[model samples]
Target chain A: MKITCSKSNLVKGVSIVSKAVPSKTTMPILECILIDATTDIIKLTANDMELGIMTEISGDIIDRGMIAIDAKIFSEIVRKLPDNEVTIETLDNLQTVITCEKAKFDIAGKPGDEFAYLPIIEKEDSIEISQFTLKEVIRQTIFSISDSESNKLMTGELFDISDNILKVVSLDGHRISIRKVPLKKSVADRKLVVPGKTLIEISKILSGEAENVVSISYTKNHIVFEFDNTIVVSRLIEGEYFRIDQMLSSDYETKVRINKKELLSCIDRATLLVKEGDKKPIIINIGDELMELKIKSQIGSMNEEIMITKEGKDLLIGFNPKFLIDALRVIDDEEVTIYLMNAKAPCFIKDDAESYVYLILPVNFNSAA
Target chain B: MKITCSKSNLVKGVSIVSKAVPSKTTMPILECILIDATTDIIKLTANDMELGIMTEISGDIIDRGMIAIDAKIFSEIVRKLPDNEVTIETLDNLQTVITCEKAKFDIAGKPGDEFAYLPIIEKEDSIEISQFTLKEVIRQTIFSISDSESNKLMTGELFDISDNILKVVSLDGHRISIRKVPLKKSVADRKLVVPGKTLIEISKILSGEAENVVSISYTKNHIVFEFDNTIVVSRLIEGEYFRIDQMLSSDYETKVRINKKELLSCIDRATLLVKEGDKKPIIINIGDELMELKIKSQIGSMNEEIMITKEGKDLLIGFNPKFLIDALRVIDDEEVTIYLMNAKAPCFIKDDAESYVYLILPVNFNSAA
Candidate 1:
């Protein structure tokens, strides 16, 4: 293979595909990135069985051939290349020569046929959404996904679409996070569970710009995302997602509207006295126009209060400070409304329009202390 | 004890003394920062038996008393406190109450009498120097200090003063680096070996500004640094420094004046092919007006050339790229002159005025391969 490209363009292409290279594998070929100049535009591809990424880079193709190079070494070389036009060509014995200005490197390469290619996904069943909205959706729900390897269903988030509304839900037996976004156009109803790790990687790659749009599609076992001349494909988690509709309701005995930043800071300060691996819960006492938070650990104790607008009966509950912090951090609101049924039931932080819903199970303070 | 101070001032003072707190220690009290409000200005201190640091902070002392609190917890609390005046007071039973705005924390504290204070270092044997100069000295020579704990002498740098020059020298078994600076006035000749770890911490705390001056002093077994209301005392490493002057020679068979940046870039690019823990040597071939650098490994081979002005006989030599890189990275000159005797002799990168010197031992390419 022979090609000429600018250093910046080559570095960008290599970095995008390097994310999918298998870090540890028995088959060495899986750690290689296939460069195909035979295509109209030069293409770089990496596949680790579970996830695959491909990007098309603009370069002058001197000859039409293909080869695979070690992803880590090739990426480092391209990044450190001088800021000028670079030429890459194959020599006898499958040796690749990469030169820029006065610097030249010769590395061994393998035939592209030995590499695995990304699986083909039919694009007929797809929907378009702005990259900004998709990134926000992933950021709000991905944190709640269970990382346990033994339980297959909890490691992925459920994607359900119907009635012009798309909902993403994640639960780890301790808390449930759900975000819903209104669609611009109606499409066929579908449900799929995407692995949490894939969504995290995708969120990092997404530009998160309102002008950029991504097409997402699903098959029986694979999901694909296409945007900005790049394609990402990952195998779907094969299992039935938990049924969560019955657990979510509008009924509540107590409701409070408090400043998000004020409550977040108060709970954050209370957490200073609690040590890691210690289940010391932050007890909250809700009353008329006041909410006091307290925590007493082996180290010390802390107490703080914030004024709030309350309605209905008063309530007292205790919760893991981290769960509250996580939900509050992702929320972009001046004030959040919370609904509580009782101390034993789940507490919900939701919007009246059902745009976003966060349910956290309270901890038994007597036992946790 | 009771005191009110701004969050920023308190945070800075706590951070300065917290560096002396032992990360892993059998004595728990060593991990605490003692706050004494009995003096006119509040003072914070921490000691790990080997190193001690103390700083005075501006505050309003409501009462006269002292207490010791956990450094880690106190620093975190002060950092997260609201942007207002923070009040820290001790109640009966040695309970400390810290409040800012509406957040309050009650933490346990110990009697300050149990805490170890910094040793008093006499200022009779002292010299004044700008903080910027001391910081620059540490940055240029600290990288060459040996990190291996086997040889105690190699793990520290020699600080010597004679006539009007202050010279600092650091060397491992394979290489030596020396940096010298001219002083305005001469003082008594003295030599001391400061531990590498102590210099690293002192460098971080020193503000690199020409207007700020730091007073450095020495005792029988301690070195003290005083500046900006802060004092740091550390035990000196005991032993005799190596005799490196006899090995430094100016006679050479070949000399080359090359662009410092160009050679550094060439060597850095060649390093991409070398893996960590791999004893790879980069061979240099110096001819009339061009220098060629080459490296070959199991993976592949790389070759590059840079233009230079050479005087004397042509030469061939090889060296471990890392040792050359460390010295080259710290140099501030645009162009450097190198003197070489032969393939088996040490290479010298030095100045005509003897302001700086770097000697590197060459590798046997035949055995290394």
Candidate 2:
């Protein structure tokens, strides 16, 4: 295979596929990226059994052939090359020669036939959505996914489509985040459990682009997302996701409105004294005209009070400070409303405009008073 | 003890002294900073048995007393407080109460008597040096200090002073860096081995100031540096330093001059293929007008040739690419001159100005032709 491509385009294409390359595996071929050269284009693909990425770049192809080279080494070499055209040619002995300016590298390549085949997506069932909207949905709900794989269902976020709205929900039993965005066209209703890793990769790639559209397709066990000249596919987890709406409280005995920045800063200050294994809990005491936050650990203790507008009854609630801070960062408003049922009930926090809702389970602490 | 001080000044003072606080040690009191409050000033001191730091800030002191508090917790509280005047008061139970605006913290304190007493400077033999010059000298030579404590003498930088000239030398057997500066006044000739950690802390604190002068004092067993209302005392490492100048060769068989940035970039690209657990040696072959660098590892290999102006006999040398990059980064000139005696001998690299010099030992490779 022989091809000549712009240095910057090849760097970007190789980097995107390198993220899916397996670092350590029993199968040696998994660490290599398959490169194919046609008359006018070069395709690069890499997979680690669970997820696969393929990208194509326009280049001047001298010959038609295929070879698989070490993904990490190729990416590093391409990143450091000077701004010029890079020529890669495969020899009869299965060694690839890469030349740029005065530098040349000979890398041993494996036969492309040994690489695993990637899933093929059908264009008939694919749906189009804005990359910016999808990125926002992933960022809002991905953080709430459970890191543990023992419960396969909780480790993935649930993507449910009904009527004309697309909803994403994630929960780790202690906290849940739900986000919804309206679709432009009506399609068949579907539900899929997308793994957190795939969502993270999609988010990273989408962060650089503007408001471009993304094409998505899914089968029973696999999903694919196509954007620009790249495609990403991942296997879906098989399980039943919990009904998160049922877990939220129906009635609240107390409600308080506070500045999001002030509350976030207060929680951050209290977290300094919260011990690691001693349960990092912060107590929030609501009064007639003020709210006081307190945290006590083995080393020290801190208290911060801020003025707030409270209604109904005065109450006290204890929760992990980190959870509060994470939820506050996602809300797109200056002021947030917190609804509390009791000391042990889950607290629902949302902006007064009610764009996004977050539910956090409160910890039962003896120091809540 | 009670005192009120500006928030910015308190944060800066506490941060400087906190660097000496021991993170983990057998003596619990070593982790605390002693606070001494007088009518006009407040002093903070911390020591880890090997190094001590004391910083004083002007404040309104209500009473004269002393107490010790955990340095980490105190610094954290001070950092998060609002930018306003802060009041720190000690209770009868030995708890330090800190209040700033609406935020309050009560930190547990230990007895001030349990803290270690810092060493006192007894002589008038002190030399004044600008913080800017001192910081530059430390940054250039500190990276060459030996990290392994097995060779106790090589772990510290040798500081030699004679009249108005000051010189610093550091060597780790394989590489050496030397820096020299002229002082304003003449002083007695002295030599001291200052630990690497002490120099790092001093550099960090002296980063922003432009005109502040550092006053240095050395005794038989300790070295002290006083600057900007802060004093740092470190115990000298007892040993005789090696005579590095004797190891340098006087004549060279091959010489080359090249752009520092171009050479550094070439070395960085070649090192990407160096494998772990194997000696990371890069071969350099000098021909009529070009230099070729090559490295081979299990995963892949790379070759890069750069243009240079050379004279004398052609030569080949093998050395660790990381050391060469380090030496290149320290050069202040755009062009660097490299002199090589032979493939097995040490290589000398420096700029034309001769303000600094770096010596790198070549690695012996049997495969080199």
Candidate 3:
């Protein structure tokens, strides 16, 4: 393949596709990015069977052909090239030559036919949503996704859509996060379990552009997200997601409204006393005109009290301090409202507006300690 | 011990002492910092047997006593405390109570008598240098120090003072860096090897002050640096540092002056072709008017050429690109001068003004390739 393109543009395009290339793939071809040159554009594609990314850039094509080159080598070389026009061409014996100003790189290339075929999404089942909203939803829920490889379903975020509202849910059995955003147009109700890896890649490419729209297509086995000349496809987990709404407490004996910054700082201080393997639980004691958070471990014990607007009966609850910090980070409000059912039941935390809800399963502190 | 100090002041003092406390010390007492309260000041000390730090903070002392508390825990608690007056006192049964605003911490404390007694330096020989100048000298040479534990002497920087001039030198077998600064006052000529760990800690503490004076004292077995109200003592590694000056060639066959930024950028690009464990060597081909740098590894091959003002005949040299980058980072000049003795000999790189000098040993690329 022969093409001439701006160094900055090619670098960005190749980087996006390279993210899907596994560092150490059993199949050597999976480590290569397929490059194709047409009359007016150059296309790059990389896949690890589970996830695939394809991006196209406008360039001046001298000859139309295709070649597969090492994704890491190509990406690194392109990233270091000076910000100027760059020329790339395939030479005899399957060698790729990249030239920019006084710098040139000659890399061995493999046959493009050796690469696995990336799944193509049909346009008929595509639904468009604002990239800003999509990125926000992913950020709020992706952190709660389980990283354990044994449970494949929990490692993916569930995207549920009905009417004109889209809801994203993620849980790691210990903590659950749910975020909902209103869509601009009504679409058919659908649910897809997209892997956290794919959601993170999509969020990175979204770039917080409110006007940019992302078109998503999904089938029973695969899901595709298309945005700004780039398309990412991933194999969806074939399993039912946990019913997160049921895991949340239905009734709360106590509720408190506290400044988000003050509560976050207090939890951060309490975390110092929580040992890594010692349950890492912070007990919250709600009393008249006061709220106390305490963490006791072998190393030390810390107690912090903050004035909050509390109501109902006095209650005490213990949960992982990291869970509360994660939930507070995503809640967009000055004040956070925490709903406690009991010491053992799950606690629901959300902003006053209730656009996002986070639930944490309280640990049995007595038994764990 | 009972004392009330400003939160910021206590945080600063605790942070400096905590640097000497090892995270995983074999002796439990070594992991704690000793706090001694006097009538008008509170002293904090932490030691790892080899290195120790002592700093005092002016505070209101309600009582005079001493205690040892976990360094990590105390630092974290002090860091999170609000910017107000903080009261810390020793309770019964070897426990310390820290109170700041509405937060309270009951940290377990060890007996102060169990802590190791750090050796105090009483040498009359001392040198006064500006903190900024000393910090700059340390930065210019410390990166070249060998990190290997096999040769303890090479893991430290050699500080040689003579005739009102102080020189810092460090070498790892492959490269040597030397920085010299003229002191305002004349001090006795002495040479001491200060461990890289001590210099790093000193740099962290010297980051804010621009013109603060640092008083350094050296003995036969240890070196002490006192700045502000803090004193840091580190054990010296007894051995002879390699004669770096003897290894440098006096006459050069060719010399080149190039823009430091351009050369640094080119070396960074050339590093992309060098893989770990590949004996990362980049070949530089210098002509009368041009310079070409090339690297071929398992990943790929890259060639970059830059224009330069050269004198004498053509020459070629092979060296590690990272060493060159490290030296380039320390050079405070727009353009740098490179002196080449031959293809196989070490090359000396320095600025037009002789403030800092870097000598890089050439790699045998013929056998490596």
Best by lDDT: 1
lDDT of 1 by residue, B1-369 (tens): 899999999999998998899999998888999999988889999999888999999989999899999999999989988889999999989999999987899999998999988887765577778999999888989888999989888899998888867899999988999999787776888888988888888888898898899888898789999999999999889988998989899899999999999899889989999998898999999999999999988777888899999999999899999998998988899999999999999999988897889999999998644
TM-score-wise, the better of 1 and 3 is 1
Task: Return whichever of 1 and 3 wins on DockQ.
Answer: 3
Model 3 iRMS: 1.2
Q: Each predicted complex: what DockQ?
A: 0.76, 0.72, 0.76
- Binned by DockQ into CAPRI classes (incorrect, acceptable, medium, high), candidate 1 is medium
List model 2 lDDT by residue over B273-366, tens digit each.
7765577699999987999888877756778888999978898889988889888887777988899988988898965555688999999877
- In candidate 2, position A101 carries an lDDT of 86
Off by over 4 Å in 2: A208-210, A367-369, B208-210
Model 3 Cα lDDT, one tens digit per residue, B274-359: 77666778889999889988988777788888899999889878898898999998888988899998877889997555678899
Give the Å error, residue B129, model 1: 1.4
- CAPRI classification of candidate 2: medium
**Candidate 2 positional error at A30, Å:** 1.9
Top candidate on DockQ is 3
Number of clashing residue pairs in every model? 0, 0, 0
Q: Write the per-residue lDDT of candidate 1 for residues A1-369, one digit (tens) a residue.
A: 799999999998888888899899998988999998987799999999899999999889998899999999999888888899999999868899999999999999998889998998866578788999999999999989999988888999998887877899999999999999888888898889998888888888899999899988889999999999899999999988888998888899999999999999988888888889988899999999999889999888888889999999898899999999999999999999999989999999988887899999998887644
